[model samples]
Target chain A: MEALLEVRELSLRFGGITALSQIGLAVAEGETLAVIGPNGSGKTSLFNCITSIYRPTSGAISFRGEPLTRHSPDEVTRLGIARTFQNLRLFHNMSVLDNLMVGRHLHFRKNLLAAVLRLRGEETRHRRRCEEIVEFLNLEPVRKTRAGDCPYGVQKRVELGRALATEPRLLLLDEPVSGLTQEEKEEFAYWIHEIRGRFGITILLVEHDLRVASRLAGRMVALDHGVKIAEGTPAAVQRHPDVIKAYLGE
Target chain B: MDLVESYAEDLRFARRPAARVLLGLLLAALAVFPWVAAEHLVFLATLIALYSIGVIGQNLLIGYTGQISFGQAGFLAIGAFAFGHLRIWGAPFALALLGAGALAAVAGVFVGFPSLRLKGPYLSIATLGFGVAVYQVFVNWEVLSGGRSGLAIASLQPMFGLSGTRWTYYVYVLLLTGFTLAAYNIVSSFIGRAFVAIRDSDIAAEVNGVSLTRYKLLAFAISSFYTGVHGALYAQILGHIEPQIFNVLESITLFVAVIIGGVASIEGSILGAVFVTLVPKVFANFREMVPVVYGVTILLVLIFEPLGLFGRWLKTRLYFQLWPFR
Candidate 1:
């Protein structure tokens, strides 16, 4: 399969602290790639570099063979990348349905005049797509609920739904199932695998929970102290000595 | 599709057909009001209508997009001066207002560019300086005022030779109606959702593919354009203009009305504007205490109802829905 995203020797630093150092990874089209690391192990830093939230201190990231060096976050998103935050960065004051509509903002074409005329055709098309995502996520019950007020699990679901609404080819999920129940984790793992096939998306996820990460990602990259310590099948990575030392507090 | 789920969805928005009909009747009453009311009352209502449009525009910026501005009066001044010049040159009224709106929108974008990096008190101070700078320019520039003495606005010609306050009165009322609907459509549509999204979390908004620069400037431009429209109407109704019309205090009055009515609610802003305008007249006897009274009213509203009158209205609506049992 063609490489959809390639991070070559990515290094991100904040003054003296190294967030990610000489990190490298590749996600193929329609593959699940998980970055598993302990707290402060630079898992999120990797995601941020790819999304262009933080320009890497050194090295390069390319999407579809084009250098993503100069792109801003929103520009990166428009290039068909979507992501969800680990702590759930949702529009707190807006209704649940409105959040989904926000995700479809890129696809809206009307401006001041057409909107003032109550033009329904353009708006209705986007609304129909948003409603489909709502229904799929089983969020119909809290469709009107303010995202801030939704239960944590539901917020995570909405965040995912929101990213999905962007119609992205690459989905970056940062700890998508951390706070989810056991059943939810299993359900979410199913969706993770299913989404790769269903949407033909390349997913790069960061999760600390080994069981969930190993279950969801076919291959895993383990990091320790800003360095990629191990990479291979999830089973093999889990048994690596450095991976054990990183998670076991050695 | 089940009971609880559907009910919650329905309650999320636009829950009242009967109440909407009642609102339509109230608007019809407003339509015919100019004919029956005394001439003085028509003038007062027209002032209220103009300010209603101004405050509605103000509400969209601070209330919806969560950007604070103390400089809308600058846009109003720019529009009024531009309209005053156009009117003096014998340009038609509608075209002149459009020109005024476009000019003010240009200024809005110009000023709103650096303002994108500002928020909270920093944004407020930047806009406050803008208002002051515009005010000084109007006062000092002989060209802007047609001289320090100010310019005279042309009287609006009667339509179809229909002579009366009723003709112009209907025009103002109809424009206000159009403006109110436009505001409604904006808040309920994709454009408004983008505003709210940027307001709530700009980082998340960018990640979700909203261009902050585009929406922020659009908000400023749209907000200023409407304020300019209000300024044009103000010039026509008053028939004279000076820099004094767009002072910092004038900006405050509109801003206060928006807060007192309800921060983000359209009806709240309009109601607040009318209430603030008329209440001062009732206490015209104690004219010295008007500002004092105004300050106290706003403080009281903030203390008792931070959401302004709209919060109480929404609560009352819920209360009535669950009446008798609750």
Candidate 2:
């Protein structure tokens, strides 16, 4: 498989406290890679660096062979990467459709003048694109609802829809199954396969549920204290004594 | 993934129906003001509408994008003085209006650059300083702005050879109505949703592919451009221009109007504009008790209706609908 992303000895620090310490990773095109760790184990921190939310203190990140530098989060997104926030940061006041439509901001080609006039078939095209995205997410039923009033599971689904709207080559999921129940996790695990199977998009997930990650991901990378301790197929990594010790509290 | 999908659904549920009807009625009333209003009332209405344009500008920056701006009046002053000076040089009214808007947009960019590095009260104070500096320029530059004494603007030429105060009043009213409608459409459009997204969470907006620098600056420039057009309109309607017309207090007044009406609500601005403009007249009726009346009303609005009249009305209506049947 062709390499879609690469991170070499990436390190991130906030003042004197090191959050991500010389961690290295690479993800192949259309592949699913799971990063599993306990709370404060640099899972989200690694995501922040990959998404350019927290600029790495030392190390290199490349997407599709292009070096990633001090670019804004949106810039990183424009380069075919999109991510969902762990805390759920949906635009609460806007309509359901509008939230997804905002994900397509990069697709807009017209200026304020053209937008105001609704000129040259712009409105029609814009409307068509919005409808396509809404349908893709199965959001037609509540396309006009406000984002703030939804249940936890559905809100998480909206975040995925938003990420998918970016037309990303690589989608980052930060604890997608963290707050869900076992049944909900099972449903989410099913959608994980669907996202990859239907969209042919690469996914790099950071999850805490070992069983879910092992089931959903073809391979897994384990981290403890901001360092990768093990990485391989789920069964191989599970039998590795370190992985067992971390999981079983040995 | 689930979080994102559910938020999308919630957003669909947020649009209210009664608000749209109220907005439509307000726009219709404003559109037909000149026919029934007295000359002085027409004059006052023109002023109110022009100021509403400034408030709308503030709303774009602070209400939509969550950036506090105290320099919108400075942009308004720039527009007023620029258009007035251009008119003196024999520029057509429309050209003068566009020129003022363009200049204000450039100024907006300058002000907004520093803002990308600042937030909260720091941003407010920086903009406040801009407003004060602009006022000083108008005070000192007698050649262009007529200094402290100010400059006189010629009466607005009537459309299609029509001439009269009534005709001009109608013209101003219609123009303002058009602008209000445009502003309404903008706030409801996709880009407008981006602004709200930026306001709610800049990081989230960026992750969703909204370029922060571009969108925020666009908000400032567009907001300032509208204020510039408003300034030109005010100059034409009043036939006078002065620094005092766009002072720091003017900035406060615009903000108060936005907050009292509803921060991000277009209809709220119109209601707030009318209230701010007419409330003084309410005090006028009480003669010596004018200040007292003004104070009491302001206090009551602040204490009893924190979201202003609009919030109170929404709450009351909701109460009636949900109350355990009569």
Candidate 3:
């Protein structure tokens, strides 16, 4: 498999505290990689750094063989990288469909003048793209429902829909099923697989749920105290003493 | 199927009677304001309308887009002085106004460029400093602004070379109508949606490919453009251009009106402007106790209804409209 993302000696620090230290990782194209860790194990820190929310103190991140540094989150997104937040961050005031439409903003071809004037081709194309996304996400029925008013499971689904709407080649999900119920978690696992199968996009998921990782991830890495202690197939990582110690109690 | 449904939804919004009636009343009011009011009051109304235009820009930035700007007065200054000076140099007042808007928009981009690196209160401070610095420049530049004393504005020319208070009355009303209509168009458009999205969750907006910098700067630019037009209108109406009119207090008053009226609301902008404008005049009899009355009213409003008077009025209107269901 071709490498879609490469992180080399990625180090991030906040004042005197080192959040991530010399951690290197690579994601292959069309692969689902999961990062599992205890709370405060730097899983979220790494995600934030990769997404440019937290600029790394020192490191090199390359996407599709090109360097990714000194770029804002918005700039990184335009390069085809999209992510979902740990907590659902859907626009609360916007309807589910409008939330999804925001993801397609990069794909909007018309300028402000065209949008303001309701130009012929621009309006039609803009409307069509919005409709296509709503259908693709199975969000037609709840399209007009405000995102904040949705159930936890549905909100997660809407976040997924939003990420997918960006048409990114790489999708990063941070605990996509964190607060979901048992049934909802199962449904989310199924959709994770479905997304990979349907889109052939690379996915990097940060999840604490072992069952979720086992169900969908092709490979897994375990981190503890800001260090990657073990990495391999899910079964191998589960068997690793350090990984088990970090999770089950030392 | 989704596209078809969306089109149906769009049609529903277009046909909504509440939106239509509200808009109709706004237009009717703006059209009739000058005809009923005295000459001095008409001038005050023009000032309010002009200030509302700037408030419309602030609403887009502070209210809808969730970008904090203290430099709105800076943009107003750019517009006012540019128009004032250009008109003094024998340029057509209309063209000067257009030029002022263009210049302010370019300056808005200059200021907004540094904003991508900042957020929240930091951005607000940066913008505030920018406004103050611009005001200082206008004041110190004696040749352009006549320094602290200010410069005189030429009277507005009417259709077919008419002049005087009556002619200016129609012009102010027409300009106010045009500004309000433009603001209305923006409030209901895709651009408006983008700003609201950015306001609510900028990270989510970006992950979905809403470029934060592009939209932020666009908000600033478009907002400055409106403010510039307002400044031009102001200069013409007052027949005077001074840095004092675009000071920090004026900026805060405009912002206060929007907040007191309601953020992200066109009606709120107008209401706030009108209430702020006329309330002082109405309280002239109370003289010494005016501040007490004003302060008490503001505190009560802020405590009981945080969304401002217009927000409360909107809730009441909506309640009546959906009476049984609500």
Candidate 4:
């Protein structure tokens, strides 16, 4: 399988504290790869580097064989990479549906003249696309409610819906089920599973829950202290000696 | 209940039929107001219309874009001075107005640079310094602004067989209506959503593909253009442009209008403008007490209705819409 996203020798440091060092990973097209690690294992740091929020001290990230280092966060999204945060970052003041619409920002016709003229054809078409995402995520009940007011589970789904709205080729989910209830987790896992098959999307997720991670991802990469400890099938990675010591200690 | 069956219906200016009727009646009243009212009242109405444009501009930066600016007076001064210069150089009224707005927009972009590094009170102070600097320039730059004595603007040329105050009133009101529609269109479009997204979470917005630098500067330019146009009209109305007129107090007043009207609301900008304009007239007998009255009114509104006058109006409408339920 061709790599949809390729990371090589990526290193991130805050002064002397290294967040990620010599971290290398590749996500193949249409595959769901989970990065499982303990707290502060440089999972989010890797995502930030890929999105260009933080400049990696060393190494390179490329999507479809094109270099992604030094591109701005919005530029990354323009290149068909979308991500959700560990903590939900919904536009609290805006409506739930509007949150999804914002994900479609890059896709919208951005002519200021057209905007000032209040042209509706293109806007209506894009809005219909967002509506489809809303239906898929089962967010129709709170579609008009403020994103800040939605329950945690709903907000998570809204974030997912928002990422999906971007129509990204590579979706990065950071702790998508961290605070979700058991039922919500199951629902989220199902959605994550369906997303790959339904949209032919490639996913790279960071999960702390091994059960959820092992269930949703066919392939797994384990990280510890900013280094990749193991990478293989979920069953093999979970049983690796390095991953066991990183999570359970000596 | 009114149902929006189509996406087009959902995006309509007045979603409900009742709102459309109310909007029609309000517009009709506005069209006839100058003819039916006294001369002084017409002048006040015109002032409100012009000031509303400035207030709307302030709201766009502070409310929608979540950027604070206390230098709107500086932009206004740029506009007023630019218009004065353009008119003196034989530019037509529309051309002069647009030139004034463009000049102010250029200044707005300059001010926006500091915002990339500063936020909240720090940004406000930087803008306040800008307002002071502009005032000082007008005071010292004799050739440009005629110095401390002030610059005299010529009266408006007759158009459509209408001249003097009535013509000015009609022109200002028409421009106000056009600008309000434009503002509405902007706030509902993708650009507006990008602005709101940045305000809510710039990180999320960037991840979702909104460039902060581009949108922030655009907000400043657009907002400044609105105020700059207002300042051009104001120069005509006052017939004299002075450094003292575009002071820190005026900047504060514009900021107050955004808050007292409601942040991120079009109707709130107009409401705030009306309140700010009418207070002095309402206290005409006690001219010295006008500022005191403004202070009291703002305090009361902030405490009782944090969302501002427009929020209160929304609540009232909702009450009636769901009558007997609560």
Candidate 5:
């Protein structure tokens, strides 16, 4: 399959300190790839660089062979890349449903005039689409709940639900299983697999737990101190001496 | 993937027939207000309605979009002057009112664009400058605003059968109701969702494909149009105006009205307008206590009810909903 996303020699630096060094990653169409690393492994930084939240000091990111530069964050999302923040950046003040509606914002083609005049023809259609996503995630119990008021695991799901509402082709999940209980993690992993099975979406996940990462991801790339140390099957990368050293710092 | 549920069906509130009846009756009473009430009281009601219209705009920007504007009165000034001039030139009231609002919307774009990247205190300062500049324009532009003396607008009575004072109540009420509903529609719609999302988190908003620059400018445009229309009507009701009428304090008062009424509630707009308007009358006997009362009221709201009148109203609703229990 053709690579959906390609990163060439990606390097990010903050003043004198480096966050990522000569990193390269390729995600093929409808494939699940995992980036596993210890703290300061540059996983989150890699996602930021792709999203252009922080422009890489050196490197190139291409989506379907198209360079992703000069596009704002919203533009990037509109280009079919949606991501979740590691810190669960849901709209805390808004309800879970409204948070999903915010995800549908890009789908709206009506201008301000059509909106102010109370044109429901387009709006109701979009709301129905959003409701489908809500049910898909089994978030009906907390549909009306404020994001800030929900439990951490539920908030994470809501964040995922929100990212899903945007109809993304590539979902950059930043630690989807973090803070989740064992059962919750299993259930979430199930959903993640189903997301690929059902929607054919390419997922580039950043994860901390090895078992969960290996379970969900078909392949793994391990980073340590901002450098790529191992790449292969999850089990193979897990046993790589350099990766072990990076995780243990031994 | 088999799920077919839609919030549009589930989220629809059961039709409230009685609420509509009550609103109709209340509007009927307001329509007849000028004839039944004392003429002076009718005039006060008209002013209050106009202020309510302006307050709705102010609150939408500050409360819903999380954008701050310290100089909303600038839009009002633009509306007032534009409307006044359009009316004097034989333009009809409806067209002139819309034209005035459009003029202000353009100014909103001008102010809103450069400040797209600006947020919080910096945005506030930019708005403050805008307000100051508008006031200065009114003061210095001799031909446009007739300078400090301001120009006399055509009386509402001769135009559209709205007798400057009494008959104009119906017009004010009509505009107030229409704009309030429009504001409600905007808030309930996805557009309002976009505004609130930006208010909640600009970064998240963009990530979800909400263009911050577009929505930020939109909030300013919609907000200023309302305030501008109110300003136009204010000139008509007052029958005369000067640059001093819409000073910096006037802008601050409008901002405060939104806060005390309810930051994000539609009903809060009217409640805030009425409370803010009546403050001067309730304390008309002792003018010195006016600011004290205003300051104390805001302080009290911040302390107890951070969401202002709307927050208190929600709490009351929940209490009633959970009545007969602790």
Candidate 6:
């Protein structure tokens, strides 16, 4: 498969602490890639670097063929990349549907004059799109409910729905199912699998739950001490000595 | 029995018949108020309308966008003086009003730049400094504001057979209605969503494709524009423009109105305006006690109704809507 996202020699440092050192990876088109690591292994750091939330100490990140390091976070999203937070970051006071609508901000006309005139055809079109996502995510029941008032599992789904609303070419989910119950986990995994087939978009996820990660990801990269310890098929990466050592300790 | 069955229904200005009727009744009352009420009452109503426009603007920045500004009086001063100068140059009334707003909006953009890096109390102090600087300029610059002695304004010329306080009342009421509608449109649109998102979580907002710099600045410009127009109307009402009129105390009064009314609420803006405008009139005999009353009212509201007056209104309305269930 052709690569959709490429990272090379990405390094991030804070004073004496190196969060990620010379980390490199590639996500191919229409494939789900999982980055598995222990706490503080820099899984989130890699996601942040690609999303332009953190400027890498050194290295290059490209989406399709365009360089991404110099762009701001909003600019990166405009380049057809969208992401979810490990801890849900839904606009708490806004309704669930509004949260999804915010994802379509870049696509809106953004003309102040049009807004004042109440020219709402474009708003309706976008609302329709969000409604569809709300239906797909089984959020129809709480569509009008404030996001902060929703249950945690529901908020998580709202976060996913929001990312999907952006119509992104590449979706990055950071621990999408970390706090979910086992039943919710299975449901989320099913959605993750369906996202790949239904949306036909590349996904890069950082997951601490190895079982769910391996189940959703066809290929896996393992990280230890901010280093890429192993990369291969899920079963092979699971069995690799380095991966085992990283998880179970030396 | 009101149900929003479609997106369009949800976005309607008055979704239910009851609301539409209430709005019609309110407009009818306002239309007849100047004729039926005493002149002093009409004057007070006009003041409320003018301050309402400014309060709404302040709410947009502090409530919706979560940017604190104690320098709003500075923008108001700019608008007042801008109008005064424009009128001196023989500009038409409408042109002078708009020019004042535009000029103040420019100043708002400058003040907003500091907000890009500052937050909370630090941002408030920076804005406070801006307000003080504007006051000093108006005080020292004789050519502009006529210095401390002040610039006298001529009474507005009547049009369409209206005159004096009635004419001024109509103009302010009409503009107030227009500005309120525009603010409503802005708060409901994607731009408004971006503002609220920044307030809630700037990090998530940026990642969701909202440029923090752009939206933050837009909030300041729009907010200041409202205050600027208010300043022009205020100058007309007072019949004088002086540096002391737009001082730090004036800024604090506007800020107080936003807090006492409600944060992030449209109704709160109007309610807060009424409270700020009428409270002093109620205590006119005990003029020195006005600040004490304001302090007490704020404390009471903060303690009992943290969401402010609008939140209390919502609860009351909800209770009535759900009557017999409790």
Per-candidate iRMSD: 3.4, 4.6, 2.4, 0.7, 1.7, 0.8
lDDT of 5 by residue, A45-84 (tens): 9998888788888989999889886688899998899999
C-alpha-based local distance difference test score of model 3 = 0.80
Point out the worst 10-residue segment of candidate 1 chain A by lDDT: A116-125
Residue A156 error, candidate 4, Å: 0.9
TM-score of each: 0.94, 0.89, 0.90, 0.97, 0.95, 0.98
The CAPRI category of model 2 is: acceptable
DockQ-wise, the better of 1 and 3 is 3
Candidate 2 lDDT, B50-163, residue by residue in tens: 767766777777778888888877888889889998898899877888898899888998888867888889999999999899988887778867866688888776676543
Q: In angstroms, give how far residue B314 of model 5 lies from its true place.
A: 2.5
Go through the candidates in order and give each one's C-alpha lDDT. Answer: 0.87, 0.79, 0.80, 0.92, 0.87, 0.92
iRMS, candidate 6, in Å: value is 0.8
Better model by lDDT: candidate 1 vs candidate 4 = 4
Model 3's C-alpha root-mean-square deviation from the true structure amounts to 3.1
Judging by TM-score, tell me the better candidate of 1 and 2. Answer: 1
TM-score of predicted structure 2: 0.89
- Candidate with top DockQ is 4
Candidates ranked by lDDT: 6, 4, 5, 1, 3, 2
Inter-residue clash pairs, candidate 3: A103-B208
CAPRI quality of model 4: high
Per-residue C-alpha lDDT of model 3 across residues A158-186, encoded as one tens digit per residue: 98988887788899999998999998888
Evaluate model 3: give its TM-score. Answer: 0.90
Candidate with best TM-score: 6
Which ranges of candidate 3 are over 4 A from the true structure? Answer: A120-124, B1-14, B21-29, B32-41, B160-163, B187-190, B285-298, B324-326
**Deviation in Å, model 6, residue A37 alpha carbon:** 0.8
CAPRI-style docking class of model 6 based on DockQ: high
- In order of the candidates, what TM-score does chain B achieve? 0.92, 0.82, 0.86, 0.96, 0.91, 0.97
